[model samples]
Target: MRRFVIGDIHGGLKGLQQVLNRCNLKEEDKVIFLGDYVDGWSESEKVIDYLITLNGNQNCVFLRGNHDDLLLNYLKTNQFNKEWFQHGGESTIEAYQKVDSKTIQNHIEFLESLQDYYIDEANRLFIHAGFTNLKGVEFEYFKPLFYWDRTLWECALALNLNLNRDSVYYPNRLKLYQEIYIGHTPVTRIGITIPHNIANVWNLDTGAAFKGPLTILDIDSKEFWQSDPLHTLYPNERGRN
Candidate 1:
Protein backbone atom coordinates (compact mmCIF):
# COMPACT_ATOMS: atom_id res chain seq x y z
CA MET A 1 0.00 0.00 0.00
CA ARG A 2 1.25 3.48 -0.82
CA ARG A 3 1.56 5.79 2.15
CA PHE A 4 0.79 9.47 1.52
CA VAL A 5 1.08 12.55 3.70
CA ILE A 6 -0.70 15.79 2.79
CA GLY A 7 -0.31 19.38 3.93
CA ASP A 8 -2.85 21.54 5.70
CA ILE A 9 -6.21 21.43 3.89
CA HIS A 10 -7.78 24.49 5.58
CA GLY A 11 -11.37 23.53 4.57
CA GLY A 12 -10.74 23.70 0.85
CA LEU A 13 -12.83 20.69 -0.14
CA LYS A 14 -12.45 21.28 -3.85
CA GLY A 15 -8.68 21.52 -3.48
CA LEU A 16 -8.61 18.43 -1.29
CA GLN A 17 -10.69 16.38 -3.71
CA GLN A 18 -8.67 17.65 -6.64
CA VAL A 19 -5.41 16.56 -5.03
CA LEU A 20 -6.86 13.19 -4.08
CA ASN A 21 -8.20 12.69 -7.59
CA ARG A 22 -4.84 13.56 -9.08
CA CYS A 23 -3.17 10.99 -6.83
CA ASN A 24 -5.75 8.32 -7.74
CA LEU A 25 -6.10 7.39 -4.09
CA LYS A 26 -6.86 3.72 -3.52
CA GLU A 27 -8.65 1.88 -0.76
CA GLU A 28 -5.50 0.13 0.35
CA ASP A 29 -3.43 3.31 0.40
CA LYS A 30 -2.78 4.94 3.75
CA VAL A 31 -3.30 8.74 3.85
CA ILE A 32 -2.34 11.09 6.61
CA PHE A 33 -3.66 14.68 6.75
CA LEU A 34 -1.50 17.38 8.37
CA GLY A 35 -4.54 19.13 9.84
CA ASP A 36 -6.19 22.62 9.77
CA TYR A 37 -9.12 20.82 8.15
CA VAL A 38 -11.40 23.78 8.66
CA ASP A 39 -11.35 27.56 8.26
CA GLY A 40 -10.36 29.84 5.30
CA TRP A 41 -12.57 28.03 2.76
CA SER A 42 -16.32 27.84 2.24
CA GLU A 43 -16.70 24.12 2.92
CA SER A 44 -15.32 23.58 6.40
CA GLU A 45 -18.24 21.36 7.32
CA LYS A 46 -18.03 19.47 4.06
CA VAL A 47 -14.32 18.81 4.52
CA ILE A 48 -14.89 17.46 8.00
CA ASP A 49 -17.81 15.38 6.76
CA TYR A 50 -15.73 13.91 3.99
CA LEU A 51 -12.93 13.00 6.42
CA ILE A 52 -15.40 11.49 8.85
CA THR A 53 -16.66 9.29 6.04
CA LEU A 54 -13.15 8.47 4.89
CA ASN A 55 -12.04 7.52 8.40
CA GLY A 56 -14.75 4.87 8.52
CA ASN A 57 -13.83 3.18 5.24
CA GLN A 58 -10.19 4.03 4.53
CA ASN A 59 -6.82 4.31 6.24
CA CYS A 60 -7.12 8.07 6.65
CA VAL A 61 -5.42 9.70 9.64
CA PHE A 62 -6.02 13.29 10.75
CA LEU A 63 -3.65 15.50 12.75
CA ARG A 64 -4.83 18.48 14.75
CA GLY A 65 -3.62 21.98 13.79
CA ASN A 66 -4.05 25.35 15.47
CA HIS A 67 -7.26 25.88 13.53
CA ASP A 68 -8.58 22.50 14.66
CA ASP A 69 -7.68 23.45 18.21
CA LEU A 70 -9.84 26.55 18.05
CA LEU A 71 -12.68 24.50 16.59
CA LEU A 72 -12.54 21.87 19.34
CA ASN A 73 -12.63 24.53 22.04
CA TYR A 74 -15.49 26.36 20.36
CA LEU A 75 -17.56 23.19 19.99
CA LYS A 76 -17.20 22.04 23.61
CA THR A 77 -18.40 25.35 24.98
CA ASN A 78 -20.92 26.05 22.21
CA GLN A 79 -19.51 29.53 22.03
CA PHE A 80 -17.44 31.49 19.58
CA ASN A 81 -14.20 33.00 20.82
CA LYS A 82 -11.82 35.65 19.42
CA GLU A 83 -9.04 33.31 18.40
CA TRP A 84 -11.55 31.14 16.57
CA PHE A 85 -13.19 34.00 14.69
CA GLN A 86 -9.98 35.82 13.94
CA HIS A 87 -8.13 33.12 12.07
CA GLY A 88 -10.76 32.17 9.48
CA GLY A 89 -12.78 30.64 12.28
CA GLU A 90 -15.68 32.77 11.09
CA SER A 91 -15.78 30.78 7.91
CA THR A 92 -16.06 27.57 9.89
CA ILE A 93 -18.80 29.11 11.94
CA GLU A 94 -20.71 29.82 8.79
CA ALA A 95 -20.22 26.27 7.58
CA TYR A 96 -21.24 24.74 10.89
CA GLN A 97 -24.38 26.84 11.04
CA LYS A 98 -25.60 25.28 7.82
CA VAL A 99 -25.63 21.86 9.43
CA ASP A 100 -27.77 20.70 12.33
CA SER A 101 -26.49 20.75 15.90
CA LYS A 102 -26.21 16.96 16.12
CA THR A 103 -24.11 16.83 12.98
CA ILE A 104 -21.87 19.58 14.28
CA GLN A 105 -21.33 17.76 17.55
CA ASN A 106 -20.50 14.52 15.80
CA HIS A 107 -17.99 16.30 13.58
CA ILE A 108 -16.36 17.97 16.58
CA GLU A 109 -16.08 14.62 18.34
CA PHE A 110 -14.43 13.18 15.30
CA LEU A 111 -11.94 16.05 15.29
CA GLU A 112 -11.23 15.55 18.98
CA SER A 113 -10.55 11.84 18.53
CA LEU A 114 -7.88 12.51 15.89
CA GLN A 115 -4.26 11.92 16.89
CA ASP A 116 -1.93 14.89 17.00
CA TYR A 117 0.85 12.90 15.34
CA TYR A 118 0.80 9.90 13.00
CA ILE A 119 3.83 7.68 12.57
CA ASP A 120 3.99 5.52 9.47
CA GLU A 121 5.14 1.90 9.28
CA ALA A 122 8.61 3.16 8.40
CA ASN A 123 8.50 5.43 11.46
CA ARG A 124 8.25 8.68 9.46
CA LEU A 125 6.63 11.18 11.81
CA PHE A 126 3.70 13.35 10.71
CA ILE A 127 2.10 16.17 12.65
CA HIS A 128 -0.06 19.23 11.93
CA ALA A 129 2.84 21.46 12.81
CA GLY A 130 5.98 19.87 14.25
CA PHE A 131 6.88 17.97 17.39
CA THR A 132 8.65 19.17 20.52
CA ASN A 133 9.74 15.99 22.22
CA LEU A 134 10.09 13.02 19.92
CA LYS A 135 10.76 10.35 22.52
CA GLY A 136 7.91 10.13 25.04
CA VAL A 137 5.52 13.03 24.52
CA GLU A 138 2.09 12.46 23.00
CA PHE A 139 0.60 15.32 20.93
CA GLU A 140 -2.63 15.22 22.95
CA TYR A 141 -0.95 15.83 26.31
CA PHE A 142 0.15 19.30 25.22
CA LYS A 143 -2.23 20.30 22.44
CA PRO A 144 -0.22 23.34 21.34
CA LEU A 145 2.84 21.13 21.09
CA PHE A 146 1.37 19.76 17.88
CA TYR A 147 1.43 23.10 16.03
CA TRP A 148 3.05 26.17 17.61
CA ASP A 149 6.03 27.05 19.79
CA ARG A 150 9.17 26.73 17.71
CA THR A 151 11.82 27.73 20.23
CA LEU A 152 13.63 24.40 20.04
CA TRP A 153 12.90 23.96 16.36
CA GLU A 154 14.59 27.27 15.68
CA CYS A 155 17.70 25.96 17.44
CA ALA A 156 17.61 22.78 15.38
CA LEU A 157 17.32 24.88 12.23
CA ALA A 158 20.63 26.51 13.05
CA LEU A 159 22.40 23.20 13.82
CA ASN A 160 21.15 20.55 11.38
CA LEU A 161 21.85 21.31 7.75
CA ASN A 162 21.45 17.75 6.38
CA LEU A 163 18.18 17.18 8.26
CA ASN A 164 19.44 14.44 10.60
CA ARG A 165 19.36 14.67 14.38
CA ASP A 166 17.66 13.98 17.73
CA SER A 167 14.54 15.54 19.27
CA VAL A 168 15.16 19.29 19.53
CA TYR A 169 12.46 19.82 22.14
CA TYR A 170 14.51 18.39 25.02
CA PRO A 171 18.17 18.31 25.96
CA ASN A 172 18.52 14.54 26.15
CA ARG A 173 20.55 12.68 23.53
CA LEU A 174 17.42 10.81 22.50
CA LYS A 175 17.28 10.02 18.80
CA LEU A 176 14.16 11.22 17.03
CA TYR A 177 12.10 9.30 14.54
CA GLN A 178 13.09 9.21 10.87
CA GLU A 179 11.73 12.33 9.15
CA ILE A 180 9.05 14.77 10.24
CA TYR A 181 6.32 15.95 7.84
CA ILE A 182 4.37 19.03 8.88
CA GLY A 183 2.09 21.83 7.64
CA HIS A 184 0.91 25.20 9.22
CA THR A 185 3.79 27.41 7.94
CA PRO A 186 3.50 27.48 4.15
CA VAL A 187 6.17 27.21 1.46
CA THR A 188 4.74 27.02 -2.09
CA ARG A 189 2.80 30.14 -2.99
CA ILE A 190 -0.02 27.77 -3.76
CA GLY A 191 1.87 24.72 -2.48
CA ILE A 192 5.20 26.06 -1.25
CA THR A 193 8.09 23.68 -0.62
CA ILE A 194 7.45 20.00 -0.95
CA PRO A 195 10.04 19.38 1.77
CA HIS A 196 10.63 22.84 3.20
CA ASN A 197 12.95 22.61 6.16
CA ILE A 198 13.13 25.19 8.89
CA ALA A 199 14.31 23.30 11.98
CA ASN A 200 15.23 19.93 10.50
CA VAL A 201 11.50 19.42 9.83
CA TRP A 202 9.72 19.46 6.48
CA ASN A 203 6.82 21.89 6.09
CA LEU A 204 4.18 21.27 3.41
CA ASP A 205 1.52 23.88 4.05
CA THR A 206 1.61 24.77 0.34
CA GLY A 207 -0.80 27.66 1.02
CA ALA A 208 -3.72 25.89 -0.60
CA ALA A 209 -6.05 28.26 1.22
CA PHE A 210 -4.39 31.23 -0.40
CA LYS A 211 -2.77 31.55 -3.82
CA GLY A 212 -1.05 28.15 -3.54
CA PRO A 213 -1.84 24.62 -4.67
CA LEU A 214 -2.72 21.48 -2.79
CA THR A 215 0.13 19.00 -2.40
CA ILE A 216 0.33 15.26 -1.92
CA LEU A 217 3.58 13.43 -1.22
CA ASP A 218 4.12 9.69 -1.60
CA ILE A 219 6.23 8.83 1.40
CA ASP A 220 7.63 5.52 0.15
CA SER A 221 8.26 6.56 -3.46
CA LYS A 222 9.08 10.25 -2.96
CA GLU A 223 6.76 11.17 -5.82
CA PHE A 224 4.62 14.30 -5.51
CA TRP A 225 1.44 15.76 -7.04
CA GLN A 226 0.09 19.29 -6.84
CA SER A 227 -3.12 21.04 -7.99
CA ASP A 228 -3.90 24.74 -8.07
CA PRO A 229 -7.36 26.14 -7.25
CA LEU A 230 -6.69 29.62 -8.58
CA HIS A 231 -6.91 28.22 -12.10
CA THR A 232 -10.50 27.31 -11.44
CA LEU A 233 -13.32 29.71 -10.58
CA TYR A 234 -12.39 32.47 -8.21
CA PRO A 235 -13.28 31.77 -4.57
CA ASN A 236 -16.14 33.62 -2.98
CA GLU A 237 -15.63 36.67 -0.77
CA ARG A 238 -15.93 34.39 2.24
CA GLY A 239 -12.83 32.53 1.17
CA ARG A 240 -10.92 35.77 1.19
CA ASN A 241 -12.23 36.86 4.57
Candidate 2:
Protein backbone atom coordinates (compact mmCIF):
# COMPACT_ATOMS: atom_id res chain seq x y z
CA MET A 1 0.00 0.00 0.00
CA ARG A 2 1.32 3.42 -0.90
CA ARG A 3 1.51 6.03 1.82
CA PHE A 4 0.96 9.65 0.79
CA VAL A 5 1.15 12.84 2.82
CA ILE A 6 -0.87 15.86 1.74
CA GLY A 7 -0.32 19.55 2.38
CA ASP A 8 -2.75 22.11 3.75
CA ILE A 9 -6.11 22.51 1.99
CA HIS A 10 -7.21 25.85 3.50
CA GLY A 11 -10.79 25.43 2.28
CA GLY A 12 -9.72 25.05 -1.34
CA LEU A 13 -11.93 22.06 -1.93
CA LYS A 14 -11.47 22.10 -5.68
CA GLY A 15 -7.73 21.96 -5.36
CA LEU A 16 -8.07 19.19 -2.81
CA GLN A 17 -10.28 17.21 -5.16
CA GLN A 18 -7.95 17.75 -8.10
CA VAL A 19 -4.86 16.48 -6.26
CA LEU A 20 -6.65 13.47 -4.88
CA ASN A 21 -7.82 12.50 -8.35
CA ARG A 22 -4.38 13.10 -9.85
CA CYS A 23 -2.77 10.95 -7.17
CA ASN A 24 -4.86 7.91 -8.27
CA LEU A 25 -5.69 6.95 -4.70
CA LYS A 26 -6.56 3.35 -3.89
CA GLU A 27 -8.48 1.96 -0.97
CA GLU A 28 -5.41 0.18 0.36
CA ASP A 29 -3.27 3.31 0.23
CA LYS A 30 -2.90 5.52 3.24
CA VAL A 31 -3.27 9.31 3.13
CA ILE A 32 -2.07 11.56 5.88
CA PHE A 33 -3.34 15.15 5.76
CA LEU A 34 -1.30 17.85 7.43
CA GLY A 35 -4.22 20.07 8.49
CA ASP A 36 -5.34 23.70 8.17
CA TYR A 37 -8.26 22.12 6.29
CA VAL A 38 -10.35 25.27 6.65
CA ASP A 39 -10.24 29.09 6.64
CA GLY A 40 -9.16 30.72 3.38
CA TRP A 41 -11.55 30.22 0.56
CA SER A 42 -15.40 29.91 0.69
CA GLU A 43 -15.78 26.17 1.31
CA SER A 44 -14.48 25.59 4.82
CA GLU A 45 -17.62 23.77 5.88
CA LYS A 46 -17.73 21.72 2.71
CA VAL A 47 -14.09 20.76 3.06
CA ILE A 48 -14.75 19.40 6.55
CA ASP A 49 -17.80 17.54 5.32
CA TYR A 50 -15.83 16.04 2.46
CA LEU A 51 -13.00 14.96 4.76
CA ILE A 52 -15.41 13.28 7.13
CA THR A 53 -16.71 11.22 4.23
CA LEU A 54 -13.23 10.48 2.89
CA ASN A 55 -12.05 9.15 6.25
CA GLY A 56 -14.80 6.58 6.26
CA ASN A 57 -13.75 5.12 2.91
CA GLN A 58 -9.99 5.29 3.17
CA ASN A 59 -7.10 4.93 5.58
CA CYS A 60 -6.56 8.57 6.49
CA VAL A 61 -4.78 10.38 9.29
CA PHE A 62 -5.65 14.00 10.03
CA LEU A 63 -3.32 16.16 12.08
CA ARG A 64 -4.51 19.28 13.85
CA GLY A 65 -3.40 22.70 12.62
CA ASN A 66 -3.56 26.09 14.31
CA HIS A 67 -6.31 27.41 12.04
CA ASP A 68 -8.39 24.29 12.71
CA ASP A 69 -8.01 24.75 16.46
CA LEU A 70 -9.17 28.36 16.13
CA LEU A 71 -12.29 27.32 14.23
CA LEU A 72 -13.05 24.60 16.75
CA ASN A 73 -12.80 27.09 19.61
CA TYR A 74 -15.17 29.51 17.90
CA LEU A 75 -17.69 26.74 17.21
CA LYS A 76 -17.66 25.62 20.82
CA THR A 77 -17.57 28.99 22.57
CA ASN A 78 -19.16 31.35 19.99
CA GLN A 79 -16.33 33.76 20.78
CA PHE A 80 -14.35 34.85 17.77
CA ASN A 81 -10.65 35.41 17.98
CA LYS A 82 -9.61 38.70 16.40
CA GLU A 83 -6.39 37.23 15.09
CA TRP A 84 -8.17 34.25 13.60
CA PHE A 85 -10.68 36.51 11.89
CA GLN A 86 -7.92 38.49 10.22
CA HIS A 87 -6.24 35.32 9.03
CA GLY A 88 -9.02 33.71 6.98
CA GLY A 89 -11.43 32.97 9.84
CA GLU A 90 -14.05 35.36 8.46
CA SER A 91 -14.68 33.07 5.53
CA THR A 92 -15.10 30.10 7.89
CA ILE A 93 -17.51 31.99 10.12
CA GLU A 94 -19.61 32.96 7.12
CA ALA A 95 -19.55 29.41 5.75
CA TYR A 96 -21.01 28.02 8.95
CA GLN A 97 -23.67 30.70 9.41
CA LYS A 98 -26.32 28.84 7.43
CA VAL A 99 -25.44 25.35 8.62
CA ASP A 100 -27.67 23.48 11.05
CA SER A 101 -26.63 22.83 14.66
CA LYS A 102 -26.36 19.07 14.20
CA THR A 103 -23.89 19.36 11.33
CA ILE A 104 -21.86 21.95 13.23
CA GLN A 105 -21.72 19.64 16.22
CA ASN A 106 -20.51 16.78 14.03
CA HIS A 107 -17.82 19.01 12.57
CA ILE A 108 -16.77 20.00 16.06
CA GLU A 109 -16.44 16.35 17.04
CA PHE A 110 -14.29 15.67 13.98
CA LEU A 111 -12.05 18.62 14.86
CA GLU A 112 -11.69 17.42 18.44
CA SER A 113 -10.67 13.96 17.18
CA LEU A 114 -7.70 15.35 15.25
CA GLN A 115 -4.28 14.21 16.35
CA ASP A 116 -1.29 16.39 17.25
CA TYR A 117 1.04 14.06 15.37
CA TYR A 118 1.49 10.54 14.03
CA ILE A 119 4.50 8.25 13.88
CA ASP A 120 4.37 5.49 11.31
CA GLU A 121 5.82 2.03 11.61
CA ALA A 122 8.78 3.20 9.56
CA ASN A 123 9.57 5.73 12.29
CA ARG A 124 8.58 8.71 10.16
CA LEU A 125 6.96 11.51 12.14
CA PHE A 126 3.97 13.25 10.62
CA ILE A 127 2.81 16.47 12.24
CA HIS A 128 0.84 19.54 11.21
CA ALA A 129 3.70 21.73 12.39
CA GLY A 130 6.85 21.14 14.42
CA PHE A 131 7.67 19.86 17.86
CA THR A 132 10.36 21.45 20.06
CA ASN A 133 11.40 18.89 22.63
CA LEU A 134 14.91 17.59 22.33
CA LYS A 135 13.64 14.30 23.69
CA GLY A 136 11.13 14.19 20.83
CA VAL A 137 7.31 14.33 20.56
CA GLU A 138 6.57 12.02 23.47
CA PHE A 139 8.30 14.44 25.78
CA GLU A 140 6.92 17.68 24.30
CA TYR A 141 5.97 20.03 27.16
CA PHE A 142 3.83 22.38 25.11
CA LYS A 143 1.03 20.60 23.28
CA PRO A 144 0.42 23.60 21.02
CA LEU A 145 3.94 23.37 19.69
CA PHE A 146 2.94 20.25 17.81
CA TYR A 147 0.68 22.38 15.66
CA TRP A 148 2.17 25.85 16.07
CA ASP A 149 5.95 25.55 16.06
CA ARG A 150 8.14 26.74 13.19
CA THR A 151 11.48 26.47 14.89
CA LEU A 152 11.85 22.81 13.91
CA TRP A 153 11.56 23.67 10.23
CA GLU A 154 13.77 26.72 10.72
CA CYS A 155 16.40 24.60 12.39
CA ALA A 156 16.30 22.13 9.52
CA LEU A 157 16.64 24.93 6.98
CA ALA A 158 19.50 26.61 8.85
CA LEU A 159 21.55 23.47 9.06
CA ASN A 160 24.66 23.05 6.94
CA LEU A 161 24.02 20.39 4.30
CA ASN A 162 27.42 18.85 4.85
CA LEU A 163 26.75 18.07 8.49
CA ASN A 164 26.32 14.35 8.84
CA ARG A 165 23.61 12.90 11.07
CA ASP A 166 26.35 11.05 12.93
CA SER A 167 28.19 14.29 13.63
CA VAL A 168 28.01 15.75 17.12
CA TYR A 169 26.90 19.10 15.69
CA TYR A 170 23.75 17.59 14.13
CA PRO A 171 20.53 18.40 15.94
CA ASN A 172 19.16 15.77 18.25
CA ARG A 173 15.65 16.55 17.02
CA LEU A 174 16.64 15.65 13.49
CA LYS A 175 18.10 12.42 14.75
CA LEU A 176 14.92 11.42 16.52
CA TYR A 177 13.02 10.20 13.49
CA GLN A 178 13.71 8.42 10.24
CA GLU A 179 12.01 11.37 8.59
CA ILE A 180 9.67 14.21 9.58
CA TYR A 181 6.75 15.48 7.50
CA ILE A 182 5.12 18.82 8.25
CA GLY A 183 2.91 21.58 6.91
CA HIS A 184 1.81 24.97 8.49
CA THR A 185 4.89 26.91 7.25
CA PRO A 186 4.43 27.30 3.52
CA VAL A 187 7.44 26.49 1.37
CA THR A 188 6.31 29.33 -0.88
CA ARG A 189 7.99 31.78 1.49
CA ILE A 190 11.30 30.56 0.03
CA GLY A 191 9.86 30.99 -3.49
CA ILE A 192 9.32 27.26 -4.07
CA THR A 193 5.86 25.94 -4.80
CA ILE A 194 6.63 22.28 -4.23
CA PRO A 195 7.35 19.89 -1.41
CA HIS A 196 10.72 20.84 0.05
CA ASN A 197 13.21 18.85 2.06
CA ILE A 198 15.89 19.98 4.48
CA ALA A 199 17.90 17.51 6.47
CA ASN A 200 15.29 14.82 7.11
CA VAL A 201 12.27 17.14 7.33
CA TRP A 202 9.91 17.31 4.35
CA ASN A 203 7.62 20.35 4.28
CA LEU A 204 4.59 19.55 2.11
CA ASP A 205 2.69 22.86 2.58
CA THR A 206 2.97 24.44 -0.86
CA GLY A 207 0.86 27.47 0.11
CA ALA A 208 -2.53 26.29 -1.09
CA ALA A 209 -3.88 28.77 1.50
CA PHE A 210 -2.47 31.54 -0.65
CA LYS A 211 -1.52 31.24 -4.33
CA GLY A 212 0.24 27.90 -4.69
CA PRO A 213 -1.29 24.50 -5.39
CA LEU A 214 -2.21 21.78 -2.94
CA THR A 215 0.41 19.00 -2.93
CA ILE A 216 0.57 15.30 -2.11
CA LEU A 217 3.83 13.40 -1.85
CA ASP A 218 4.46 9.67 -1.89
CA ILE A 219 6.43 9.09 1.26
CA ASP A 220 8.41 6.18 -0.12
CA SER A 221 8.99 7.08 -3.78
CA LYS A 222 9.24 10.85 -3.31
CA GLU A 223 6.96 11.31 -6.33
CA PHE A 224 4.29 13.98 -5.92
CA TRP A 225 1.20 15.49 -7.51
CA GLN A 226 -0.30 19.00 -7.28
CA SER A 227 -3.46 20.72 -8.32
CA ASP A 228 -3.61 23.94 -10.32
CA PRO A 229 -2.76 27.04 -8.28
CA LEU A 230 -5.58 27.83 -5.86
CA HIS A 231 -5.94 31.29 -7.39
CA THR A 232 -6.79 29.67 -10.69
CA LEU A 233 -9.28 27.31 -9.07
CA TYR A 234 -10.97 30.07 -7.06
CA PRO A 235 -10.56 33.03 -9.36
CA ASN A 236 -13.37 35.00 -7.76
CA GLU A 237 -11.90 34.73 -4.27
CA ARG A 238 -8.69 36.20 -2.90
CA GLY A 239 -7.96 33.20 -0.68
CA ARG A 240 -5.66 34.30 2.14
CA ASN A 241 -3.90 37.01 0.22
- For model 1, residues 1-241, the per-residue Cα lDDT tens digits are 8888888777788888888899999999989888888888778889888999888888988888888888888877878778668778888887776798899789878877878777766667787765555353453456677777453344444554554454454333124556667787666533444556554366677777666777888887768887775225235444533
User: TM-score for every candidate vs. truth?
Assistant: 0.84, 0.99
- The total of clashing pairs for model 1 equals 10
**Cα lDDT of model 2 by residue, 1-241, tens digit:** 9999999999999999999999999999999999999999999999999999999999999999999999999999999878889899999999999899999999999999999999999999999999989999999999999999999999999999998888999999999999999999999999999999998999999999999999999999999999999989999998985
Quick one: RMSD of model 2?
0.7
Q: All models: lDDT? A: 0.72, 0.95
Native-to-model Cα distance after best TM-score fit, residue 73 in candidate 2, in Å: 0.0
Off by over 4 Å in 2: none
Clashing pairs in 2: none
